[model samples]
Target: MTELREAAPSAGTDLLDERTRELADYCAAMTGRLRVIGQRLDRDPDAITEFLHEPQVRFPVQGMLPPQYRSAGEFPAPLVAASSTVLGQVVATEQVAYGDPNVILASPGPSLSGGVVQALADEQQRQRYFGRLAAAPTHTFFALTEPAKGSAALELETTLTPAPGGGWLLNGAKCYIGNGARAQLGVVFCRRAPGPWGIEAVLLDTSAPGFSGELLPTVGLRGARISRLRFQDVAVAPEDLLGADRSPSRRGLYGATYILYRFRPGIAAMALGCAQAACDYLRTHRATLPRQDRHRLDGVLDRIAAVRHRTYAVAAAVDAGVVDVAGIGAVKARAARVAEDATRLVAELLGPASLIEHPWLEKTYRDVRAFELMEGTTNLHTMAAFQSLLRSRTALQPAAQRAVDGAARH
Candidate 1:
């Protein structure tokens, strides 16, 4: 929560600030390139490497790096500032995702791993890796999902045992790791002993001996290159362990929690963007449709606006030192459902064959689905929201009883 409060909101009456608006305009310009290469990348996931030089692919990646690590000249103040903050990223991601979520998802950058880096990496670790990323366009993955269990603390089977000579040996298999196969460097989470406190994170090099990553089959977001990684006694240097010098309590699973808090807004924005794209597409193609369908589209658009504002508000709250996990969870879950519903409604409105007829819409229909699986599942979020509801009921009891007592006296 302390780290969450670090990003102060820039001065603005509107939800978006001037810098955020500038970044949005810049992202809007890059949409054409993403639209162009999206299909190609879908057909061949490896094609992501070919477009590294493109602004859409290059800028967002550069935008995520802090000013100090940015090797690129003068970290364009607008996008660069937005790049570091939750609210800034929320504005940028929604716009970029409008064109194609795959463009940002598949691009080589810190991305999902950046939050973890910020949450845990020490000065030396940050300088060593972020510096390398700044110097070149390198794909990165945040390895948490595992072969058997999907990041369940107790069920996690990955191990980081001490090596015979020194340091540690990483042995595990991670599934559903985006950019895992192609990534030259990234972070991996594993357990050194048992229980939650056993968890430890390490800076991982794809080239390390016994480390292997392979692309997994994906129906949607084919360009995302969701992959599987295997580590068989892969050696980890002492310096590679994140927060190793800290006490066991400080080095536990909270860092992972912090990363989730940091990125939930951006995740919601991705879904919102996808939903908006579908709605806009349907409006353009089916404007002459009967009044009923037009009204339905209007309702959908309204929902997007309401949810967009909610997403922005939650992001601003986090920036202002209020990390309302319940609100955030509800927003992320609702955004995802809205995205799915938008695509479904648009498909019906656009005609039965629209999915087959329109290539981009079809890709979008497939792409929006991947968001539900990102960060956390919708079910998990809804339950968190429900838990908050129960807590709120208890929290209001004292005031509620005082009001009742005053009425009784009267």
Candidate 2:
């Protein structure tokens, strides 16, 4: 643990020199903000929720960080770390205020890949000029999953039909949409003009006519406000399209792929946080327990630490650009499973204490379980990785085929 701490600075520097310094400074400032938020939440949790709803506080990044940082792997680590602090504050505040056990499974801002961040930044100048605001506690939805389709994103079902006036009329319903009910703006993935395979992302105003959302009562991460969104003849102006106005096939898959890669690191980070929290809870409660319990706690702690380390290593690989996108599925799959194990460990250590609502352990346990199903489920990721490997093998066969042909000719 001490070695990991010592190596953090150098590892950060190796990723990006000057940018790392800027990130450190930014993190320091964010830390202060988070401290203040945490204090306020501790005192009056409702205030934190209300503050999050405020436009000013809702857009935390605002002018503080530039959007260009999203493409580089080095940029998101500090930003995500800072964001996680805010998430922790939210969790703390929610628990304190409502006395209800809930978990924050989805974040409103950019994907770990920085795509949404870049999109937001590009639109910033226009948003300011038009005074057409996009605010948060601003809910943003990743409408990738569907009921009819398998986890294969290429089989998307939602369709976006272009209108006569160059606007768009969206006709589809998105399920498992996090922040669907409360989000003012939504980033919806849809197939434009044709069918599911032509997926594209478009920004839509939730208040617009023909936009509706229904709550999804979930088993965990209940506080995340997951829901199903229906867009029936929802009229969206041309400007709502997130990326370039190219063919959906050309842009949609690329955007989705980018999101997949970008969010891998963030997912791992969240898992690490959960594992650390679980381990800490166990450590704190171990002393009062029996010797047998203590030994069990120690074993759980060791396992948690190992999983946390593995999660961090995966994030580091992403930052270094050493991660294979296809292989990322394996990492994500393993991380989700590890998160489940860590949650279980916490439960075992806490015994009846784990069931209590006040402590974060119970909530985190439920929240971590959600990870196993979110993004690409563990089974789906495994299949994707295998398919990707098979594709690579198939691509290599042409070389061998040509070599055999040449030998025969000789």
Best by lDDT: 1
Model 1 worst lDDT run, 10 consecutive residues: 1-10
For residues 332-387, write the lDDT of model 2, one tens digit per residue.
Answer: 67656766786786677666655684345555566678777767777777887889
Model 1 TM-score?
0.92
Model 1 clash number: 0
Task: Give the clash count for each candidate.
Answer: 0, 1
> Which residue pairs of candidate 2 clash?
113-262
* TM-score versus the correct structure, for each prediction: 0.92, 0.69
| Model 2 stretches astray by more than 4 angstroms | 1-48, 51-114, 117-137, 164-166, 193-197, 247-249, 288-310, 313-323, 352-354, 389-410
For candidate 1, the lDDT comes to 0.80
Q: What are the per-residue Cα lDDT tens digits for candidate 1 across 225-268?
A: 89999999999999989888787666647667777787888889
Predict model 2's lDDT versus the native. Answer: 0.54
Error of 2 at 164 (Å): 4.8
